[model samples]
Target: MVAAYQKLCPETLDGACRELADRDPALDRIYRERGCPPLWQRRPGFRTLVQIILEQQVSLASGRATMKRVENAIGRVTAQSLAGAGESGLRAAGVTRQKALYCTLLARAAMDGELNLGRIARVRDHEALDMLTAFKGVGRWTAEVYLLMALRRPDVWPAGDLALAKALQAVKKLPVKPGEDVMRTIARPWRPFRAVAARMLWQEYLCRNRAASAASG
Candidate 1:
Protein backbone atom coordinates (compact mmCIF):
# COMPACT_ATOMS: atom_id res chain seq x y z
CA MET A 1 0.00 0.00 0.00
CA VAL A 2 1.10 3.57 -0.61
CA ALA A 3 2.09 5.70 2.30
CA ALA A 4 -0.36 8.37 3.48
CA TYR A 5 2.22 11.06 2.81
CA GLN A 6 2.64 9.91 -0.80
CA LYS A 7 -1.06 9.68 -1.61
CA LEU A 8 -2.89 12.73 -2.97
CA CYS A 9 -6.14 13.84 -1.43
CA PRO A 10 -7.92 17.18 -1.71
CA GLU A 11 -5.96 18.39 1.28
CA THR A 12 -2.67 17.27 -0.22
CA LEU A 13 -3.51 18.90 -3.54
CA ASP A 14 -4.28 22.16 -1.78
CA GLY A 15 -1.12 21.90 0.28
CA ALA A 16 0.96 21.20 -2.81
CA CYS A 17 -0.59 24.12 -4.65
CA ARG A 18 0.16 26.45 -1.75
CA GLU A 19 3.75 25.28 -1.60
CA LEU A 20 4.10 25.58 -5.39
CA ALA A 21 2.58 29.04 -5.36
CA ASP A 22 5.06 30.10 -2.69
CA ARG A 23 7.96 28.87 -4.83
CA ASP A 24 6.90 29.69 -8.42
CA PRO A 25 4.86 32.56 -9.84
CA ALA A 26 3.70 30.65 -12.94
CA LEU A 27 2.22 27.81 -10.90
CA ASP A 28 0.73 30.30 -8.48
CA ARG A 29 -1.01 32.00 -11.37
CA ILE A 30 -2.46 28.69 -12.45
CA TYR A 31 -3.68 27.97 -8.94
CA ARG A 32 -5.29 31.39 -8.67
CA GLU A 33 -6.75 31.34 -12.20
CA ARG A 34 -7.77 27.79 -13.02
CA GLY A 35 -8.54 26.70 -9.44
CA CYS A 36 -7.38 23.33 -8.16
CA PRO A 37 -7.05 20.46 -10.60
CA PRO A 38 -9.19 17.37 -10.16
CA LEU A 39 -8.06 14.52 -7.96
CA TRP A 40 -7.44 12.22 -10.91
CA GLN A 41 -7.15 8.85 -9.26
CA ARG A 42 -7.52 5.34 -10.68
CA ARG A 43 -7.87 1.92 -9.12
CA PRO A 44 -4.54 0.10 -9.19
CA GLY A 45 -4.93 -3.23 -10.95
CA PHE A 46 -4.90 -5.17 -14.21
CA ARG A 47 -7.72 -3.20 -15.82
CA THR A 48 -6.11 0.16 -15.18
CA LEU A 49 -2.72 -1.14 -16.27
CA VAL A 50 -4.13 -2.40 -19.56
CA GLN A 51 -6.09 0.80 -20.01
CA ILE A 52 -2.88 2.78 -19.66
CA ILE A 53 -1.27 0.52 -22.23
CA LEU A 54 -4.06 1.27 -24.69
CA GLU A 55 -3.60 4.96 -23.94
CA GLN A 56 -0.07 4.87 -25.27
CA GLN A 57 0.33 7.19 -28.28
CA VAL A 58 -3.43 7.82 -28.44
CA SER A 59 -5.77 10.55 -27.37
CA LEU A 60 -7.40 10.09 -23.98
CA ALA A 61 -10.85 9.75 -25.54
CA SER A 62 -9.65 7.15 -28.01
CA GLY A 63 -7.92 5.23 -25.27
CA ARG A 64 -11.07 5.28 -23.16
CA ALA A 65 -13.15 4.03 -26.10
CA THR A 66 -10.75 1.19 -26.77
CA MET A 67 -10.66 0.25 -23.11
CA LYS A 68 -14.43 0.19 -23.06
CA ARG A 69 -14.51 -2.15 -26.03
CA VAL A 70 -11.95 -4.37 -24.37
CA GLU A 71 -14.01 -4.50 -21.19
CA ASN A 72 -17.13 -5.34 -23.21
CA ALA A 73 -15.39 -8.09 -25.11
CA ILE A 74 -13.85 -9.76 -22.07
CA GLY A 75 -16.58 -8.81 -19.60
CA ARG A 76 -13.80 -8.72 -17.02
CA VAL A 77 -10.36 -7.29 -17.46
CA THR A 78 -8.23 -9.67 -15.49
CA ALA A 79 -5.12 -11.73 -16.08
CA GLN A 80 -7.09 -14.85 -16.84
CA SER A 81 -9.61 -13.07 -19.01
CA LEU A 82 -7.00 -11.13 -20.92
CA ALA A 83 -4.90 -14.24 -21.35
CA GLY A 84 -7.95 -16.03 -22.70
CA ALA A 85 -8.68 -13.14 -25.09
CA GLY A 86 -5.43 -13.76 -26.96
CA GLU A 87 -4.55 -11.57 -29.94
CA SER A 88 -7.60 -12.15 -32.11
CA GLY A 89 -10.08 -11.35 -29.36
CA LEU A 90 -8.10 -8.26 -28.52
CA ARG A 91 -8.02 -7.28 -32.19
CA ALA A 92 -11.76 -7.78 -32.30
CA ALA A 93 -11.99 -5.30 -29.46
CA GLY A 94 -10.23 -2.65 -31.66
CA VAL A 95 -6.82 -3.23 -30.19
CA THR A 96 -3.90 -2.76 -32.55
CA ARG A 97 -1.70 -5.75 -33.35
CA GLN A 98 1.31 -4.34 -31.50
CA LYS A 99 -0.80 -3.40 -28.50
CA ALA A 100 -2.41 -6.80 -28.47
CA LEU A 101 1.02 -8.35 -28.26
CA TYR A 102 1.98 -6.02 -25.46
CA CYS A 103 -1.18 -6.69 -23.45
CA THR A 104 -0.81 -10.40 -23.99
CA LEU A 105 2.75 -10.29 -22.77
CA LEU A 106 1.68 -8.47 -19.63
CA ALA A 107 -1.19 -10.90 -19.04
CA ARG A 108 1.06 -13.89 -19.50
CA ALA A 109 3.59 -12.48 -17.12
CA ALA A 110 0.93 -11.96 -14.50
CA MET A 111 -0.60 -15.37 -15.08
CA ASP A 112 2.76 -17.06 -14.79
CA GLY A 113 3.61 -15.23 -11.59
CA GLU A 114 6.63 -13.68 -13.21
CA LEU A 115 5.25 -10.29 -12.19
CA ASN A 116 3.31 -9.86 -8.99
CA LEU A 117 1.68 -6.48 -8.70
CA GLY A 118 0.16 -7.22 -5.29
CA ARG A 119 3.52 -8.10 -3.80
CA ILE A 120 5.09 -5.00 -5.27
CA ALA A 121 2.33 -2.71 -4.01
CA ARG A 122 4.06 -2.14 -0.70
CA VAL A 123 7.54 -1.69 -2.15
CA ARG A 124 9.38 1.59 -2.60
CA ASP A 125 8.68 3.80 -5.59
CA HIS A 126 11.84 2.74 -7.39
CA GLU A 127 11.03 -0.92 -6.91
CA ALA A 128 7.41 -0.43 -7.94
CA LEU A 129 8.55 1.37 -11.09
CA ASP A 130 11.09 -1.36 -11.86
CA MET A 131 8.52 -4.11 -11.31
CA LEU A 132 5.96 -2.44 -13.54
CA THR A 133 8.46 -1.63 -16.28
CA ALA A 134 10.00 -5.09 -16.28
CA PHE A 135 7.08 -6.28 -18.36
CA LYS A 136 6.65 -5.48 -22.05
CA GLY A 137 4.42 -2.56 -23.19
CA VAL A 138 5.03 -0.85 -19.82
CA GLY A 139 7.60 1.86 -20.40
CA ARG A 140 8.77 4.72 -18.22
CA TRP A 141 5.79 6.86 -19.17
CA THR A 142 3.30 4.11 -18.50
CA ALA A 143 4.95 3.19 -15.23
CA GLU A 144 5.06 6.79 -14.11
CA VAL A 145 1.40 7.29 -14.98
CA TYR A 146 0.45 4.16 -13.11
CA LEU A 147 2.32 5.47 -10.12
CA LEU A 148 0.78 8.90 -10.40
CA MET A 149 -2.85 8.14 -11.24
CA ALA A 150 -3.36 4.75 -9.69
CA LEU A 151 -0.95 4.86 -6.78
CA ARG A 152 -1.56 8.58 -6.16
CA ARG A 153 2.12 9.15 -5.76
CA PRO A 154 2.87 12.78 -5.10
CA ASP A 155 6.36 13.13 -6.59
CA VAL A 156 5.97 11.23 -9.88
CA TRP A 157 6.49 13.15 -13.10
CA PRO A 158 5.93 11.84 -16.61
CA ALA A 159 8.33 14.14 -18.44
CA GLY A 160 8.02 12.23 -21.73
CA ASP A 161 4.29 12.93 -22.12
CA LEU A 162 3.62 15.11 -25.16
CA ALA A 163 0.55 16.68 -23.61
CA LEU A 164 2.56 17.56 -20.50
CA ALA A 165 5.26 19.17 -22.64
CA LYS A 166 2.63 21.07 -24.57
CA ALA A 167 1.00 22.21 -21.36
CA LEU A 168 4.37 23.38 -20.05
CA GLN A 169 5.09 25.25 -23.26
CA ALA A 170 1.71 26.96 -23.24
CA VAL A 171 2.15 27.93 -19.60
CA LYS A 172 5.71 29.18 -20.09
CA LYS A 173 4.96 30.62 -23.54
CA LEU A 174 7.88 28.74 -25.01
CA PRO A 175 8.37 28.92 -28.80
CA VAL A 176 8.75 25.17 -29.05
CA LYS A 177 7.83 22.13 -27.01
CA PRO A 178 10.59 21.14 -24.69
CA GLY A 179 12.30 17.77 -24.93
CA GLU A 180 11.93 15.11 -22.21
CA ASP A 181 15.25 16.11 -20.65
CA VAL A 182 14.12 19.73 -20.55
CA MET A 183 10.79 18.73 -19.07
CA ARG A 184 12.60 16.77 -16.39
CA THR A 185 14.83 19.77 -15.70
CA ILE A 186 11.85 22.07 -15.48
CA ALA A 187 10.13 19.74 -13.02
CA ARG A 188 13.13 19.67 -10.68
CA PRO A 189 11.89 22.68 -8.75
CA TRP A 190 8.50 21.03 -8.26
CA ARG A 191 10.26 18.08 -6.55
CA PRO A 192 8.09 16.38 -3.89
CA PHE A 193 5.01 18.09 -5.27
CA ARG A 194 5.67 17.30 -8.93
CA ALA A 195 2.51 15.23 -9.37
CA VAL A 196 0.48 18.16 -8.09
CA ALA A 197 2.33 20.36 -10.57
CA ALA A 198 1.48 17.85 -13.29
CA ARG A 199 -2.21 18.07 -12.36
CA MET A 200 -2.02 21.84 -12.59
CA LEU A 201 -0.39 21.63 -16.03
CA TRP A 202 -3.05 19.21 -17.25
CA GLN A 203 -5.74 21.49 -15.91
CA GLU A 204 -4.19 24.42 -17.77
CA TYR A 205 -4.08 22.37 -20.93
CA LEU A 206 -7.76 21.50 -20.55
CA CYS A 207 -8.76 25.08 -19.89
CA ARG A 208 -6.83 26.30 -22.94
CA ASN A 209 -8.34 23.59 -25.10
CA ARG A 210 -11.85 24.46 -23.96
CA ALA A 211 -11.25 28.13 -24.64
CA ALA A 212 -9.91 27.45 -28.13
CA SER A 213 -12.83 25.20 -28.88
CA ALA A 214 -15.27 27.81 -27.67
CA ALA A 215 -13.60 30.45 -29.83
CA SER A 216 -13.67 28.14 -32.86
CA GLY A 217 -17.28 27.34 -32.20
Candidate 2:
Protein backbone atom coordinates (compact mmCIF):
# COMPACT_ATOMS: atom_id res chain seq x y z
CA MET A 1 0.00 0.00 0.00
CA VAL A 2 1.14 3.52 -0.72
CA ALA A 3 2.12 5.42 2.38
CA ALA A 4 0.14 8.52 3.27
CA TYR A 5 3.27 10.60 2.90
CA GLN A 6 3.82 9.32 -0.63
CA LYS A 7 0.32 10.19 -1.75
CA LEU A 8 -0.17 13.83 -2.75
CA CYS A 9 -3.24 15.77 -1.61
CA PRO A 10 -4.28 19.37 -1.98
CA GLU A 11 -2.55 20.38 1.26
CA THR A 12 0.67 18.62 0.33
CA LEU A 13 0.49 20.07 -3.16
CA ASP A 14 0.37 23.58 -1.74
CA GLY A 15 3.13 22.82 0.72
CA ALA A 16 5.24 21.40 -2.06
CA CYS A 17 4.63 24.48 -4.14
CA ARG A 18 5.79 26.64 -1.29
CA GLU A 19 8.86 24.49 -0.74
CA LEU A 20 9.80 24.46 -4.41
CA ALA A 21 9.15 28.14 -4.84
CA ASP A 22 11.45 28.93 -1.94
CA ARG A 23 14.25 27.10 -3.73
CA ASP A 24 13.69 28.22 -7.35
CA PRO A 25 12.84 31.71 -8.48
CA ALA A 26 11.13 30.49 -11.64
CA LEU A 27 8.88 28.19 -9.61
CA ASP A 28 8.28 31.05 -7.17
CA ARG A 29 7.11 33.26 -10.02
CA ILE A 30 4.65 30.59 -11.07
CA TYR A 31 3.22 30.30 -7.55
CA ARG A 32 2.98 34.06 -7.18
CA GLU A 33 1.29 34.56 -10.55
CA ARG A 34 -0.75 31.38 -10.98
CA GLY A 35 -1.28 30.49 -7.33
CA CYS A 36 -0.91 26.85 -6.32
CA PRO A 37 -1.52 24.66 -9.33
CA PRO A 38 -4.63 22.51 -9.28
CA LEU A 39 -4.27 19.06 -7.74
CA TRP A 40 -5.48 17.58 -11.04
CA GLN A 41 -5.80 14.17 -9.47
CA ARG A 42 -7.39 11.40 -11.56
CA ARG A 43 -9.10 8.38 -10.13
CA PRO A 44 -7.03 5.19 -10.09
CA GLY A 45 -8.61 2.60 -12.38
CA PHE A 46 -8.80 1.13 -15.88
CA ARG A 47 -10.69 4.12 -17.32
CA THR A 48 -8.09 6.68 -16.35
CA LEU A 49 -5.31 4.53 -17.82
CA VAL A 50 -7.10 4.37 -21.16
CA GLN A 51 -7.47 8.13 -21.14
CA ILE A 52 -3.71 8.42 -20.68
CA ILE A 53 -3.23 6.07 -23.62
CA LEU A 54 -5.42 8.34 -25.74
CA GLU A 55 -3.28 11.29 -24.66
CA GLN A 56 -0.07 9.76 -25.91
CA GLN A 57 1.55 11.70 -28.77
CA VAL A 58 -1.42 14.05 -29.13
CA SER A 59 -2.53 17.42 -27.92
CA LEU A 60 -4.44 17.29 -24.62
CA ALA A 61 -7.53 18.82 -26.21
CA SER A 62 -7.46 16.27 -29.03
CA GLY A 63 -6.99 13.42 -26.58
CA ARG A 64 -9.92 14.62 -24.48
CA ALA A 65 -12.16 14.91 -27.53
CA THR A 66 -11.28 11.38 -28.55
CA MET A 67 -11.97 10.11 -25.04
CA LYS A 68 -15.38 11.75 -25.21
CA ARG A 69 -15.97 9.99 -28.50
CA VAL A 70 -15.09 6.68 -26.94
CA GLU A 71 -17.54 7.32 -24.15
CA ASN A 72 -20.20 8.17 -26.73
CA ALA A 73 -19.46 5.01 -28.71
CA ILE A 74 -19.53 2.77 -25.66
CA GLY A 75 -21.91 3.34 -22.78
CA ARG A 76 -18.96 3.50 -20.42
CA VAL A 77 -15.21 2.88 -20.47
CA THR A 78 -15.09 -0.20 -18.23
CA ALA A 79 -13.16 -3.30 -19.24
CA GLN A 80 -16.29 -5.19 -20.30
CA SER A 81 -17.68 -2.28 -22.31
CA LEU A 82 -14.36 -1.57 -23.98
CA ALA A 83 -13.80 -5.21 -24.90
CA GLY A 84 -17.27 -5.39 -26.33
CA ALA A 85 -16.60 -2.24 -28.36
CA GLY A 86 -13.42 -3.83 -29.80
CA GLU A 87 -10.79 -2.19 -31.96
CA SER A 88 -13.13 -1.40 -34.81
CA GLY A 89 -15.51 0.43 -32.52
CA LEU A 90 -12.66 2.38 -30.97
CA ARG A 91 -11.24 3.23 -34.40
CA ALA A 92 -14.69 4.43 -35.51
CA ALA A 93 -14.75 6.54 -32.38
CA GLY A 94 -11.69 8.55 -33.57
CA VAL A 95 -8.92 6.45 -32.02
CA THR A 96 -5.98 5.68 -34.25
CA ARG A 97 -5.59 2.04 -35.28
CA GLN A 98 -2.49 1.80 -33.09
CA LYS A 99 -4.25 3.23 -30.06
CA ALA A 100 -7.24 1.04 -30.74
CA LEU A 101 -5.03 -2.01 -30.52
CA TYR A 102 -3.60 -0.70 -27.27
CA CYS A 103 -7.01 -0.06 -25.75
CA THR A 104 -8.13 -3.55 -26.74
CA LEU A 105 -5.01 -5.09 -25.28
CA LEU A 106 -5.61 -3.31 -21.99
CA ALA A 107 -9.26 -4.34 -21.92
CA ARG A 108 -8.37 -7.99 -22.49
CA ALA A 109 -5.75 -7.88 -19.78
CA ALA A 110 -8.13 -6.34 -17.31
CA MET A 111 -10.96 -8.69 -18.19
CA ASP A 112 -8.73 -11.72 -17.84
CA GLY A 113 -7.64 -10.60 -14.36
CA GLU A 114 -4.06 -10.30 -15.53
CA LEU A 115 -4.00 -6.60 -14.79
CA ASN A 116 -5.56 -5.84 -11.44
CA LEU A 117 -6.05 -2.18 -10.62
CA GLY A 118 -6.30 -2.99 -6.93
CA ARG A 119 -3.00 -4.83 -6.96
CA ILE A 120 -1.46 -1.94 -8.84
CA ALA A 121 -2.64 0.43 -6.14
CA ARG A 122 -1.17 -1.70 -3.37
CA VAL A 123 2.22 -2.33 -4.92
CA ARG A 124 5.36 -0.28 -4.46
CA ASP A 125 5.87 2.53 -6.94
CA HIS A 126 8.45 0.74 -9.10
CA GLU A 127 6.45 -2.46 -8.92
CA ALA A 128 3.32 -0.60 -9.96
CA LEU A 129 5.17 0.90 -12.91
CA ASP A 130 6.52 -2.50 -13.90
CA MET A 131 3.09 -4.10 -13.75
CA LEU A 132 1.54 -1.33 -15.85
CA THR A 133 4.31 -1.49 -18.47
CA ALA A 134 4.19 -5.28 -18.68
CA PHE A 135 1.29 -4.85 -21.06
CA LYS A 136 1.95 -3.76 -24.62
CA GLY A 137 1.39 -0.06 -25.52
CA VAL A 138 2.05 1.08 -21.93
CA GLY A 139 5.44 2.74 -22.11
CA ARG A 140 7.41 4.57 -19.43
CA TRP A 141 5.62 7.81 -20.17
CA THR A 142 2.21 6.17 -19.90
CA ALA A 143 3.10 4.37 -16.70
CA GLU A 144 4.66 7.46 -15.13
CA VAL A 145 1.64 9.53 -16.00
CA TYR A 146 -0.63 6.99 -14.31
CA LEU A 147 1.48 7.12 -11.19
CA LEU A 148 1.66 10.88 -11.16
CA MET A 149 -1.93 11.70 -11.98
CA ALA A 150 -3.97 8.68 -10.98
CA LEU A 151 -2.02 7.24 -8.08
CA ARG A 152 -0.83 10.68 -7.03
CA ARG A 153 2.63 9.35 -6.29
CA PRO A 154 4.59 12.27 -4.95
CA ASP A 155 7.86 11.88 -6.83
CA VAL A 156 6.96 10.50 -10.26
CA TRP A 157 8.06 12.64 -13.17
CA PRO A 158 7.17 12.04 -16.81
CA ALA A 159 10.35 13.25 -18.48
CA GLY A 160 8.98 12.31 -21.91
CA ASP A 161 6.07 14.75 -21.65
CA LEU A 162 6.36 17.45 -24.33
CA ALA A 163 4.60 20.13 -22.32
CA LEU A 164 6.95 19.66 -19.39
CA ALA A 165 9.94 19.83 -21.76
CA LYS A 166 8.67 23.03 -23.29
CA ALA A 167 7.95 24.47 -19.85
CA LEU A 168 11.44 23.56 -18.70
CA GLN A 169 12.90 25.25 -21.74
CA ALA A 170 10.93 28.40 -21.10
CA VAL A 171 11.52 28.50 -17.34
CA LYS A 172 15.22 27.83 -17.61
CA LYS A 173 15.45 30.09 -20.66
CA LEU A 174 17.18 27.42 -22.68
CA PRO A 175 17.87 27.97 -26.38
CA VAL A 176 16.25 24.62 -27.26
CA LYS A 177 13.82 22.12 -25.80
CA PRO A 178 15.43 19.73 -23.35
CA GLY A 179 15.89 16.08 -24.23
CA GLU A 180 14.66 13.42 -21.76
CA ASP A 181 18.06 12.91 -20.18
CA VAL A 182 18.59 16.64 -19.69
CA MET A 183 15.10 17.01 -18.33
CA ARG A 184 15.65 14.23 -15.79
CA THR A 185 18.94 15.72 -14.70
CA ILE A 186 17.43 19.14 -14.20
CA ALA A 187 14.46 17.69 -12.31
CA ARG A 188 16.61 15.67 -9.91
CA PRO A 189 16.97 18.54 -7.47
CA TRP A 190 13.20 18.70 -6.99
CA ARG A 191 13.37 15.17 -5.49
CA PRO A 192 10.28 13.92 -3.63
CA PHE A 193 8.21 16.85 -4.83
CA ARG A 194 9.11 16.74 -8.50
CA ALA A 195 5.54 16.07 -9.51
CA VAL A 196 4.44 19.36 -7.92
CA ALA A 197 7.28 21.11 -9.71
CA ALA A 198 5.99 19.63 -12.97
CA ARG A 199 2.52 21.09 -12.24
CA MET A 200 4.07 24.50 -11.71
CA LEU A 201 5.92 24.37 -15.00
CA TRP A 202 2.82 23.11 -16.79
CA GLN A 203 0.91 26.07 -15.36
CA GLU A 204 3.55 28.41 -16.78
CA TYR A 205 3.46 26.70 -20.17
CA LEU A 206 -0.33 26.65 -20.55
CA CYS A 207 -0.80 30.21 -19.29
CA ARG A 208 1.94 31.59 -21.52
CA ASN A 209 0.57 29.84 -24.61
CA ARG A 210 -2.98 30.95 -23.83
CA ALA A 211 -1.78 34.54 -23.49
CA ALA A 212 0.14 34.30 -26.74
CA SER A 213 -2.94 32.99 -28.54
CA ALA A 214 -5.03 35.76 -27.06
CA ALA A 215 -2.52 38.37 -28.22
CA SER A 216 -2.41 36.87 -31.72
CA GLY A 217 -6.19 36.76 -31.92
Provide TM-scores for the models.
Answer: 0.96, 0.95
Backbone clashes for every candidate come to 0, 0
What's the lDDT of the predicted structure labeled candidate 2? 0.91
Worst 10 residues of 2 by lDDT: 1-10
Tens digits of per-residue lDDT for model 1, 108-157: 99899987878767787788999888888899999999989988889889
Top TM-score prediction, candidate number? 1
Model 2 misplaced stretches (Cα beyond 4 Å):
1-4
lDDT of each: 0.90, 0.91
Q: 175, model 2: CA deviation in Å?
A: 1.4
How far off is residue 53 in model 1, in Å?
Answer: 0.2
Q: By summed lDDT, which 10 consecutive residues of candidate 1 come out lowest?
A: 1-10
Q: RMSDs, each prediction?
A: 2.2, 2.2
Task: Look at candidate 1 and tell me the lDDT of residue 42.
Answer: 94
lDDT of 1 at 13: 82
